[model samples]
Target: MVEKESSRHPEVALSLPFTGLWLARNSPARRVPSHGTDLFGERYAIDFVGVDERRRTAGHRDWRTFLATEPADRFFAYGRPILAPADGTVVEVHDGEIDHAGRRSQLALVPYMLGQAARVRQGVRAVAGNYLVIALPGGAFVALVHLRAGSVRVSPGEVVTAGQHVAACGNSGNSTQPHLHMQVMETRDFSVARGVPMAFRHFRERPRGARQFHTREYGVPAEGAVVEPLPLPGAHSTS
Candidate 1:
């Protein structure tokens, strides 16, 4: 498949939402643009799924089980901590949506894909599920969606620092598996927001075949790449 052009567009400084090896999907450079709407602020959104060293979503799931279908818990990302991607004030928070089961089966995915329009019409809660919107410096509003149920730790008006534990990844809303869906917008209200460009700061990127990751600063990870966040210098304790 022809890849969508990787965006070299510079954006506000941000950080990867999770630690460890997370595989990027539907990235801005994927065959298609990362998301469906530029109207309600998701033009450059990206999806991330956790993976292990073997490049599998799970350490020991049968290949047949992975491709055919399984519960959301079967994936490697379920309940994993999703850190604050940037320091910001929480402008919006939505919770209480059921963390639905996963659907890796193409048979299930085809129907789910077809029902996307219906889900859209159901409104923000239907599409984003439980989520948080943070208003950062420089007028960027970041949305971290598809969060695990009962895992959100901040309130609408709370101030969050970068690297803080915020939520867990989950297969919520329209998500077929537990993953983090992150995007930056021009405004706080998603209904009228416009997607803004964004690149994570101080992360490590490993291309599909690379044995080691190289430090990346202010870089947007390519589609289908795996990445991890590096702690800021002196941020980790030796103990």
Candidate 2:
């Protein structure tokens, strides 16, 4: 427990939660106050979606996948363990949302986009899906959102070390595909918590179509950039 509440927020850089080519979208560094709905609270949230060599978010598609949405299992990110971005205590967990089907077609996306308002009014479960809140050091809180159903590995109050496997990425809540929606905040209650700017400790980034990734010590991944975490000297990706 902290002895005295510190007013000055420290510059806390975290580990990128997963491995491989994850494309960042709606990153705060690229655009201030990222999404429209983000104006509510997730003003600085970043959405990470894994992509393959061809830059496709999913694999081969068939008629079944086109007419009806495909299962989350088809996406590259599905079932990948989401690592803890920093050492922290599990402050909140909500894992009841069913992993929704993946959608890449513009036809399916239209209806889903129209329903955003309803999900907003329905509450956090509808929007954040199966998510967890980590109360990190220096009084910063992080919300890892849209996890797969039943993939959470820790319970509330449990202490988690940085890079520990916490949950698997999924297309739950208001998500259309398997991806991780991460954001930092001042408090554990994200609904009322103000967004806190966050950066990664050490990672490699390459924009789409780039030949090489430039290594960065401590910085935020730019929007549309593909990133991967640089494993610590003796440690590697958990799963």
Q: What TM-score do all the candidates reach, one by one? A: 0.88, 0.91
Q: Show where candidate 2 strays beyond 4 Å.
A: 1-10, 37-40, 64-67, 234-239
Q: Candidate 1, clashing residue pairs?
A: none
Q: Which ten residues in a row have the lowest lDDT in candidate 1?
A: 1-10
**Candidate 2 per-residue C-alpha lDDT over 1-239 given as tens digits, one digit per residue, 9 for 90 to 100:** 21212223454578899877798988876876766454435866889998886667887798746666787899999988899988889999998789998987777888999999999899888988999999987888999999999999999999998888899999899898999999887788866877777778778888866888899888878878888888877765453
What lDDT tens digits, residue by residue, belong to model 1 across residues 1-239? 11223432336678787889899887865633467557457788889999987768865455545466677888899999988887889999888999987777777688789998999899888989999999887667899999999999889888888888888999889898889998887787878876767777788888877888888876788887889888887553110
What C-alpha lDDT values do all the predictions have?
A: 0.80, 0.83
Most accurate candidate by lDDT: 2
What is the Cα-based lDDT of residue 192 in candidate 1? Answer: 85
Candidate 1 segments whose C-alpha is farther than 4 A from its true place: 1-10, 29-33, 60-69, 236-239
- At residue 172, give the lDDT of candidate 2: 94
* lDDT for position 157 in model 1: 88
